[model samples]
Target: MDFSFPKNERIKSKKLMEAIFTEGKNLNNFPLKLIYLPSDFDDDTQFKVAVVAPKRNFKKAVDRNRIKRLMREAYRLNKGVIFNNSERDFALVFLYLGKEMPDFQLMESKMTGLLEKFLKKIANEEAV
Candidate 1:
């Protein structure tokens, strides 16, 4: 597995973001709201993810950046489980929804659980 989260697999395009908001399913645990859609890329080695914190929740840019950084760090460390699995190429957007800033460990745990649930959801959908 290429441990890198490359740009091509990322959901950066405005069209893809709109599709995720309008077409993809939503999943959440605590501080995270996940919006995802399966990628057309057939490669089974890498996935792309984006972390976002709404300006409404965090009025200050610094706070939003901090939260996004923490979210990315958590995802980076735990994403190995997802990349190694058969369903590797996907576009995932993670939004931080909670009002208050959460500790890194707490956010990490929530991110990990959400990713596991995401993997299971994909597998189940493929099975159908």
Candidate 2:
């Protein structure tokens, strides 16, 4: 499976970003909080995502960038978990909330858990 995060799968539209923040449901997974919404898009991709590291929590720009990078890597590697058995498209914003920088393994594990939770939530929503 292709694990590359392409341009079409990155959330870059300003209006959609605003809408997601306002209307999306959020899931808190300690170091990360995910805000996601069902989205309408012309492309066939199942999900588009954005990663954020708040300046307030990560004082240094480098630190924030590093965290964002790690998050992206973990998501890219495991995104298939969310793609399987799903018909709806989604826009997701992953907000890093921790004060301290975490290692790659921790980020991967947390990301895996977060994706599992997200998929279950989506399934529940569809069922209801």
Candidate 3:
């Protein structure tokens, strides 16, 4: 499976971002919160993702950027789970709730769990 995170998968729209925060349903896994909305997209990508590291929690821009980068990496690696199972498009935002910095291992593991749960929810399948 392809593991690349291409430019098209990034969520860059202001309106969609607002809609995600306002009306999307959320799934939480500790420091990682997955806010997902089923929507049609012009692109062929199965889902569009945005990563958020709150400025209030992370005061330094460097810290915030680092957290966002880590989250994106985690998502990129694990996103195949979502892509292979879903028949429709979605808008997803990953909101990091940790006040402190996290290692890549932690981020990736949390991302994996969050994604597994998301897949279960979407498929309406019994947990494995």
Candidate 4:
């Protein structure tokens, strides 16, 4: 499968962002947190996501931006877990919650675990 993170697959709408935070369910793995909301969107992409690094934890813009970049790369590589397994659209937010910086390997592994947990939860819910 193509592993490109096109702009259309990224979240940019203020309304959608607010809806994600207000109506979404969260799955967390320490430094990474995923908040996901099932929704209908005009785009054909199965998921539209945003990555955020809080300024409170990372005081410098450079630090926050680096964290966001790492989060995005990890998500881009690992998002197929949801894309291939599910048949619905979701607005997802990936939040960086740690006070310290993390390497890409750590980020990617945790992201994979978080997505797996999400799949299990969704499967259980649907089965029930």
Q: Best-fitting candidate, measured by TM-score?
A: 2
TM-score of each: 0.87, 0.97, 0.94, 0.96
Which tens-of-lDDT digit does each residue in 3-101 have in candidate 1? 555566555678767877888788888779898876665444255577889999899999999999898888878878787775446778999999998
Candidate 1: Cα lDDT at 36? 85
**lDDT for each candidate structure:** 0.80, 0.92, 0.91, 0.89
Per-residue lDDT of candidate 3, residues 1-128 (tens digit) = 79998889889999999999899988999899999998899878889999999998989999999999999999989888888887878999999998889999999999999999998898773333
Cα deviation at 2, candidate 4, in Å, is 1.1
Q: lDDT tens digits, residues 19-123, model 2? A: 999999999888988999998899888899999999988789999989999999999999888887578999999998888999999899999999989989999
What candidate 1 gets wrong by more than 4 Å, as runs, is 1-9, 41-45
The runs of at least 3 residues in candidate 2 whose Cα sits more than 4 Å from the true structure, single-residue gaps closed, are: none
Top candidate when judged by lDDT against the true structure: 2
Once all C-alphas are superposed, what RMSD does model 2 give against the true structure?
0.8
Query: Candidate 1, after superposition: displacement of residue 35 in Å?
Result: 0.8
Better model by lDDT, 2 or 3?
2
lDDT of 1 at 54: 93
Per-candidate Cα RMSD to the true structure, in Å, reads 2.3, 0.8, 2.4, 0.9
Tens-place lDDT per residue, model 4, 1-128, is 67889999999899999998988999999988989998898868888989999988889999999998998888888877888898878788999888899999999999999989888878887789
Write the candidate numbers in order of decreasing lDDT.
2, 3, 4, 1
